[model samples]
Target: MTDRTDETDDTHRPGDQPEQHRVTDGGVTAAPGREGAIPEEDTNVTEVFPEGNLDLRAGADNCYKCTTCDTSCPVAEVDEEFPGPKFQGPEQWRLKRKEDADIDGSIMSCSNCMRCDSACPSDVPLSQMHNEARGEYVDDQMDALSTEYVRNRILSNYRTSAELASKVPQLANFAMNFGPARWVMEKVLGVTKEREFPEFAEQTFREWWRERGGAHVQSSEKRIAYFHGCYSNYNTPEVAKAMVRVFEHFGYEILVPPQKCSGTPMFANGMLDDARRDAETNVENLASAIADGADVIASCTSCSLSLRQEYPELFDIDGVEDVSDNTFEAVEYLRIYEDLEGELADAELDGQSFGYHGPCHARNQGLHRQAVELFRDVDGVRVEDVGDSCSGISGTYGWKEEKYDTSMKIGEEMFEHMKHAEGEAGMTECPTCAMQMEHGTGYDIYHPLELLEDALVD
Candidate 1:
């Protein structure tokens, strides 16, 4: 919000004498040689305020009170208490510039689904401003360490929890399903009792790769580095395996690089600092893989979005742009770089029908139609675009106790569409969307990679 843009003093000539001396924030007095001259050390203010680079505050000025974003927001339509993106994003962002501005409690209600970003006609980065504001609000409340804060912290770093739970997955799964444990989580941690937790796999994808001699496979000319995010690594290793199988069939050597969580949950929960750390780690590792003659890809749409878009937009880290340029979603990578349609032309699906619920992040990335088109190209496969509605489970948003009802409410339209749609099952690229779809409608949801993997011939 600070006016970091450099201003030019057009009134003074290049050889004009100094009129007055001014002291800068860095405690350096500028000896006026030219009108616009300032201390060289004060040029980069980001060193003093690292958070300056994380926010798109300047974009807030572009909002012209158009209600396009408001109408498109799924949360705003469902929750009246929540102000739409017009007020919550650019309008609130302007107010946040003041030191004494009161932070709206409703900002926490934002699902961060990013429909506002796509709907804005003025190219305003509405969601980015909201995300930064949420971080400010969370930091302000950290001293109290409220139950909601504690719950957010727990959910934000779900990678750690998943890793620990995966060690003894059966017991972990049992504890989650146990009624008394659920009550304890509900009462103490603010997790909702209505939603069932995702089950951890007995073995992780990395462990399976090592055990099955996948790590020793000879490198092919076409290589891809897989960024199997937390969900695919822990809860649904089968999806990761399906990706591996399909990629190998295309004669591409798979490289599983050392990576961390995609930081989608951290961003959604207003843990910008945590998300920055994740971006730094992932960019370093994925950039290294790219430097080694491999392209980066993720099966999870959120993970791909984090690597390909969020990191560059929210962080000023080295190699972030390079990593972003090279990263692609799994099906997207295949479609762009390989002959996916031609390769799958002969493959048969036996007339399977699927209702495709495009994830919000995928829509934000503008690649939602890629999967739909690819699936439609397959013989005897029916794919339906089951409306562009938010699943309301924006990562960890729906899991919180206070948000459970709101989350379900926001998802009602999508759930209704899925219930009536003629399909063998629901198909999507997001793990959390799959979970929410299954929860809302008593139907099985699967990643498109799993279906494509089964349909492809060896």
Candidate 2:
């Protein structure tokens, strides 16, 4: 509601300045404690002040707002509370995160979708804004609820995954049983009872890559390492496999090098410290790969977006900084296929009609049209674009029992769109959105590649 577009739109209550924020008790501005030295970060009594108008200046230099921004927004339509990044980034953040609220919750429900940036008419670098906001919050000690959740999930998933992997011989096969497993997690670990979490794959995408003799391509002219993120790494190895297939189809060798997370989840959830740790690990692991003529291609939208942008923010490690720019999402990478003649793999469902649900993170990376073009090239693929909007599943935010009804409610319109489409599946590039579509609408969801891979020659 608060528009920061106008330079003169600022309305500060009498006493606040750039130095210290004023606390208001009801209508009256409360005086500072004893020392009126308009506080700084070092002194802390938890001061409160109205947010300043933040101008992400995203309108021009931002990731152009595309239809996908609206499509992937979790609360765009249903909740009058949010008007999308156009509203939040330039308007709310101008004053709040820039001036008042902590960075973490300042952009609550954003889910780091970055879809807005993807769909931005002007291609605003929205992912950058959100990441920067979050970093600011962490530096300023922003709200830690999301960060707390992220920390717990990381530890919880790691431990639980190890335990589950211990019980199941093939982890990938066992991941299919996440339904019952998630229920158990609800009662035991208190991971929001309703949220759906992906089960860890028995074999990592990297492991699968090696088994497929991916290592033998050491001498290939085209070598692109795929950082499959945690979801694709542990649960949806199929997506990575599909990407590998596509890469091979183009005569490119796909590498599954040793790497940790991109740190978007950690930063978004307030695990600034933890996020830094993950970023550092990735930088160290990818050192050889990036330096050795390897290009990074990724399938997980969130992971791709994170590695391309957020990693530098978390640690500023020289290794990641050198190559993050070279990373590309599956869709981004596939565009090159378009530049050259390409064939569809999952062409079996080529004519099968479906709607495209871009994830916020993927949107941020600006890949909807590229993805749309990829499927459109297929004989049976017909994509009806849902345009800009959130899918209401802000990654794991939609997984909590308390957030279940709300998450689905936020995505109700998109759900209906998928339901009425008469398509064989609800297609999205995000794993979390796939989970949301299935859980929210009881519809089978497929990554665009899955639809194509099923049509493969082999």
Candidate 3:
């Protein structure tokens, strides 16, 4: 096993280059040491702004320093280095405009759970600011071609990795579990040895959809385009099947459109440019579905958040606004259509129970307990709200070597709750949360849709 310590790389700063420091993206300056000081005119820089040219200063003006965001932060609960969302968000926003405001390294610890955005009585987009600040911080600390940069770039492209892994799952899983392979990853890629990797499905959801006569399937006017995310499509195709069955059972035509990763991983990892590009692509792809009278739906809360919220808030994209209006979280969509609950009421779960782990992002969307409520409607099914808790696996954050321990620590309470719950299985909207729950508690986890599908009375 690798020797682990609580040490952080904060102290490793290059020699002072005050003259060379130049503010680039209105956030942070470049890294400390370089060959020669590059002039601003010589650099081909284009700062990507959010749609509506979102005024960060205007949003920052809403802060009254109530400490509400700080108190509500899940990351701050685990890591003290993170001074809380208030500091990283509005407070920093106010500070950054000052003539002499240093880049706060502590903001890097934020998982971007977005709980602070909900916690704010003033409704400050604190988490959004922190996310942008993180991108800037990453830009300031590392060069584009640095080892960490390359590693992050690869990790951010999880869809590509998943595609390859799904093609040869056994070999991929073996490579991940093998000691020497893990050692190489820890040493070279900065992924931790102890972290359990999610297994890839033998067949992708898209492949399964095609085999099941997806193109031939016809239905009523009610239609939905499923955004299965990377996990449901590649890691857990069964969830995708369950979602389709449940949707079809409720009398909706399911459209499985060609989709890409929602760029949550890229945003979380500070790859803003790539994330923006992904947002642009996804929004454009979703357009045809939206135009065909199909509302876009996603089972994964993070993916839904990206499609319905993040793209509009964090990236300048044309179709994002339209997509946001038409997009829905799977359960949230079902919750709105009360007749679906009536259909679920007839489903026989036979005393089946689930300890529902409401993901932070799902809660951030304000549809709290939608999954639990959906499960509760089934006959003989007992659903316990395991309390709103951060699963600590904020996309790729928990996969990194340095952040692994903190991730596990943040998840300890939720894991303990699952361990003691009456349910035999765990339920959650976010796939990464499911991965963390299964790893932490050694219990089989299911997407709420899977439970719903299983409960369906033929």
On the 0 to 100 scale, the lDDT of residue 372 in model 2 is 69
**How close to the true structure is residue 59 of candidate 3, measured as C-alpha lDDT?**
61
TM per prediction: 0.87, 0.70, 0.85
Supply the TM-score for candidate 1: 0.87
Q: What is the model-wide C-alpha lDDT for candidate 2?
A: 0.61
- Model 1 Cα lDDT, one tens digit per residue, 320-406: 988888888999888888888887888887788888899999998887777788877788888888888899999899999999998
Per-model root-mean-square deviation over C-alphas: 6.6, 9.5, 12.1
Order of candidate numbers by TM-score, starting with the best:
1, 3, 2
lDDT of 3 by residue, 85-178 (tens): 8888877766766535666887767888888877877667776787788787677776778667777788899998888888899999888788
Error of 1 at 179 (Å): 1.4
The order by descending lDDT is 1, 3, 2
Which candidate wins on lDDT? Answer: 1
Best prediction by TM-score: 1
Better TM-score candidate (1, 2): 1
